[model samples]
Target: MNQTLHAIAPEKGRKNKSTQDDVVYAHIFDAILEQRLAPGTKLNEESLGEIFGVSRTIIRRALSRLGHEQVVVLRPNRGAVVASPTIEEARQIVFARRIVEKAVTELVIDNAEDSQIDKLNQLVLEEQECFSRGDRGAGIRLSGEFHLQMAEMADNPPLLSFQRSLVSQCSLIIAQFESGAKSHCSYDEHFELIDAIKKRDKSKAVRLMMHHLDHVEKKLSLDDDNASDDLKAVFSNVRGKK
Candidate 1:
C-alpha cells in the first residue's frame, strides 16, 4: 500500500472504509475510460492522491484491483499506469463482445418485462440528451449502459461478470478511437431495440443487438483510410507524460 492513499480520507471511519476506495477506483476508472487518462498515462501516487483526495495506499489498492481487471497495469518499479492496449487486443475485445452481447440480448428478451423495457427506453432518452449537448463522455457511458441494463435484466451473475469485463475492454478500444466523438449508432436504433423488446421479439432483439455491436466495431475501424501514425498520435498525444 502506498502511503498517499490514506490521506484522501483523513476523517474518522472514512480512511478504512472500502466505500472511499470504490469512489477512488471509479473516478480514476472513468478518467481512463473517457480518455481523460490515456494509455501509458502514469498514475503517480502524488497526483492521484491529490485528485481523489486519497492516500497513495488507497490509490495503489484501487489500481491493483484495476490491474486484476485488466483496466490498469502495474509496472515493476514504475508504480501504476493506464493499460496501453495493442491493435490485436482491440480486435479480440470487439470480437468477444459481438458474441457475448448477442447472447446477452437474447437472455434479456427472454426474461425482461414491460417495465424493464420502459426503463431502457427512458435511458435511451437520456442518451440522446447527452449526445445533443456534446457530452460524448456521458453519451458513450449511456451507450454502454444499455448492455449493463440488459445484463441486469437477465439476472445472470456469472454472465454479468463476464459482460463487465467485456465492457471494460471495449472502453479501452473506444478510448483509442480516432475522434473523441460519441458512437455513430444513431439514436433511432435504440428506439427500434425498445420497440422490439416491447413486442417480446427475442430473435429480433438479438439481431438488433448483433447489428449494434457490429456498428460499434465498424466505427472503430473506419480509419483504414487514415495513416496509422496519425491515429496513433491521436491517442499518444492525449495520453500521459513519459
Candidate 2:
C-alpha cells in the first residue's frame, strides 16, 4: 500500500485526546478506502496503541467511530477488526448506494455551482492519472471520492454523511468479493456524468449514475470469499519504525 503512517509521536506535545483520535481514525479509514487494510484484517487495540503511541482508550475511540460507520466491527472481548460484509449485505449496500447516489445526481444538477463542477473535473483528471501510473489502489479510492464529491455538491449534509458510510462499506465489499478481473469505476463515465450535470440533464445524469453503479455491482463476485487476518503483517509497512 502506498499509504504511509505519519508519525504520531506520543511525545510531540500532543496532549489533545480528540486530535489523536482523529489522526488514528483518518489513517485507518484511508487505509480501508485504499484497500490497504483488507477485509477481516485484525485491528488489535494493543497493537494499534503501540503503533500510534496512544492508549488503548484512544484507539478504542477511533475504532468506535469506524464501527459506527460499519467499516470496522468491534467485539466485546475479541477486539476490533476491519469489517467483512456478507454477500447478502454487499448486495443491499450496493443497492442502497445506487438509490442515494441517484438522488445525489439530481440534487447536484439542481444545486451545484459551475465552480463545483470544475472541481469534479479536476478530480476525474487526477483519478485517470493515478490509473495510468499503475496506482490502482489510489485510483479506486479516488473513484469513490468522485461519488462523495457529488454528495458534497448536492448540498445535503445528511446525504453526504450517509454516502460516506455506504462508500466505505462498498469498498470492503469490493475488496472481499471482487472478481480477479476487477471492473473499477471508469473515469470516462465520470467525465460523462460531469457533462450531463453541466448541461443540467437530470435524467441523463441520474441514468448514468445508476448505470455506473450497476457496472460496479456486476463486477463483484458475491459467491467467493477472500481476506487477510494478520494484523502484524497487514500493518507492518503501515506502522512507524521504533
Candidate 3:
C-alpha cells in the first residue's frame, strides 16, 4: 500500500490524531467518489494504518464511520471493503435522490441568497472546466458537490445530512454500474436548474431537478453481472508500489 500511502499522506509535521483520522476518512471517501477506489476494494486496517502513519484504532474509526454511511461494509473476519451496491439498492438510491433533491431545489430557491446562487454558478463553471480538460474524475466529484452545495444552500442540517448520504451512495452506484463513456451530471442541465432557481420558479426548478436525475440514472448499464471479485487485481495499481 505504499503508493496509496504516498498519494494520501498528510503533509509533513501536521500529525494530530483527530486530524489524521479525518484525513484518512476524507481520502478514502474522495477516492471512492473519483472511482480510484473501486467497489470491493479491501480496506485492510493494518495496511491502512501503515499507509496513513496512524494506528489501527484510527483506521477502525474512519472505516466504522464509512460503514455507518453504508459506503463501506464491515464484515467480521473479512474486514472493510468498498460497498458493492445491489441493483435494487441502486434503484432505491436514485428514487430517494429524486425525492430529496426536488425538495432541496425548491428550498434553495426559497432560501438562497444572491451570493449563494453565484457560488453555485461558479461551481458549474469549474465543473465544465474539469470536463473540458479531460479530468473526468474531478468532474464527477464536482458534479456530486453541486447537489451537496444546493442542499447546503437550503440551510437545513437534517436535509443536508440525508442528501450527503444519498450522494455518497450514488457515487458507489455510479462506480458499480455506469459505463466509462457516461459522465455523472450533465452541465447544461445543472445550468438550467440554476436558471430556474434564479427566477425563483419552484415548479420549473423541481421539474428540471427530477428530469435531471432521470437523465443521470438512465446513463447507467445496470444489467451487467460482471463485478470484480479479485482483491489483488482491484488494488494492484493503487497499493504496494514501493
Candidate 4:
C-alpha cells in the first residue's frame, strides 16, 4: 500500500446514495491502482459483469465513467481495455502530479496546526507498521495518501477534492508505467517530507516532494516495452518467494 488514497473507500455499511454502477467503478478503479489489472488488459463485458454480479449495462456504465477519467479506453471494434497510457501521457501525469502536490505541500506548511501534524505522525507510524509486516498493499495505499492527507492539512475543501482526483489518476499511471509497484519512498522519505512540513520548513518539503516525483518518473521503464502483461508479471514478483 505504498499509496493509500483508495483504501478509504465508501464506508462498508453506508449506502450513501451511490448506485451499483458507481460501486463497480470504484472497485475496478481500485483494482487498477493495486495493479490487479495491468494496463492494456482486455476487459470483456460479460466477464466483468459476471465478476461484479452486474449486467452488461451496468458494466458499460462503469467502463464509460472510467474512460472519461482516462483510466480505461474504449475503441471502435476493440471494445474496452485498461488504459495503456503512452510515455507522453506518462510525462504529463508526472507533470500534473508535481503541480498538484507541490501546491498542497506549500499549503500544508502555511496552514500547519498541531492536530494535523499529530495525525500525520500517527499515519506514519501505521505506515511503519505496514513496512515491518511486509504489507506492500498498505505501503502503496499510504504513499498516495501522504499527499492527500497533506491536502487536508491545508484545509481547502475544493483543492483537496481536486488533489484527491489527481492522486487517483496518478495511481493509475504508476500502476501501468512503472516496472515495479515498489514506490519511491521505500526508505520512508514520506516521513522526512512530513517532518519538514511539521517543522514549517516549506521550502525543504517542496524540494523533497519534487525530487521524489522525479525519482519515481525515472524508475519507469518507458522504453520499448509495449507488453504490459509480461512486465506486470515481473512487477508482481517484487516480494514473492519462488
Please give the TM-score that candidate 3 achieves against the real structure.
0.82
Question: Per-residue lDDT tens digits of candidate 3, residues 1-242?
Answer: 12222222223253343365666776676567556675777898887776667789998988987887688999998899989887777888999999899889889989999999998898788778878887765666677778888988999888888887888788667756777544445678999999999999999999999998887777776654444544344345545432
Ten-residue stretch with the least lDDT total in model 3: 1-10
Per-residue CA lDDT of candidate 1, range 20-114, in tens? 56666755665565566657767777766655566788878888867765778899998887787776677788889888877778888789988
lDDT of each: 0.67, 0.76, 0.74, 0.69
Report how far residue 55 has shifted in candidate 4, in Å.
2.5
**1 against 4, candidate with superior TM-score:** 1
After aligning candidate 1 to the native by TM-score, how far in Å is the CA of 20 from where it should be? Answer: 2.3
Better-scoring candidate (lDDT), 1 or 3: 3
Q: Per-residue lDDT for 104-133 in model 2, tens only?
A: 999999999999999899878988888788
Ranking of all candidate structures by their lDDT, best first: 2, 3, 4, 1
Q: Which ten-residue region of model 1 has the weakest summed lDDT? A: 1-10
Per-model TM against the reference: 0.78, 0.84, 0.82, 0.75
**Model 3: residues >4 Å from true position, as ranges?**
1-18, 180-185, 222-242
Q: Model 4: per-residue lDDT, tens digit, 115-197?
A: 88887777777767766677655655566666767887788887777776666666676665676544345337778887898
Better of 1 and 2 by TM-score: 2
Off by over 4 Å in 4: 1-19, 74-78, 180-187, 222-242
| Model 4: how far residue 215 lies from native, Å | 1.6
